[model samples]
Target: NAGVTQTPKFRVLKTGQSMTLLCAQDMNHEYMYWYRQDPGMGLRLIHYSVGEGTTAKGEVPDGYNVSRLKKQNFLLGLESAAPSQTSVYFCASSYVIGAGRNTGELFFGEGSRLTVL
Candidate 1:
């Protein structure tokens, strides 16, 4: 069902270059998230949205921006790329299975790898 899909599976950029990663989900989930994975750091949240037309900063929101204008899509933009931003980015979406509670279950995209030179 194409639970979650991330575009540009891999990319390389020079300092100051710009790019955008696209995430699309068909599950119509209420929550969407962007996370970056680095060695030994697991996954660190960069941004998230509770629903369409709403977004919020996450654990590591710097150097990145996100937009969720549509319920099925989430876009992550790097205005000016940097070496520190080189990592594997993942997009996830989930729904609340219970009343006002999240089970911490997420359906993730394949991942987009960004390399900054």
Candidate 2:
């Protein structure tokens, strides 16, 4: 089974265009996250969900929105794409260890690279 999967794999957009990225997991994880990676900045959280139907903004959520309509899927949307929003996005999921705690080992999907001009 695919532990985690990300769609489009790659995309290119012009400024102001909009698109959505899809992520799916089959491990029944209760926690899911969206992150973006830049050249030297590592990865930055864009949004996350603690459980199905619950979503919250992360560190770099400014240019993105996310939804967790079902336990096994997460969706990230860009309302209006911008050049600065271009980056390699990653989707991850893991089990919640204890209340507010995590094992720190996340299952990651193959990255989705998006570029905006």
Give all candidates' CA lDDT scores: 0.97, 0.95
Best by TM-score: 1
RMSD of each: 0.7, 1.1
TM-score of each: 0.97, 0.95
lDDT by residue (2-113, candidate 1, tens digit) is 7999999999999999999999999989999999999999999999999999999999999999999999999999999999999999999999787878869999999999
Candidate 2 per-residue C-alpha lDDT over 1-117 given as tens digits, one digit per residue, 9 for 90 to 100: 989999989999999999999999999999999999999999999999989999998998998989999999999999999999989999999997887678889999999999999
Judged by whole-model lDDT over C-alpha atoms, candidate 1 comes out at 0.97
Per-residue lDDT of 79 in model 2: 94
Give every collision pair in model 2. none
Once fitted onto the true fold, the runs of candidate 1 whose alpha carbons sit more than 4 angstroms away are none
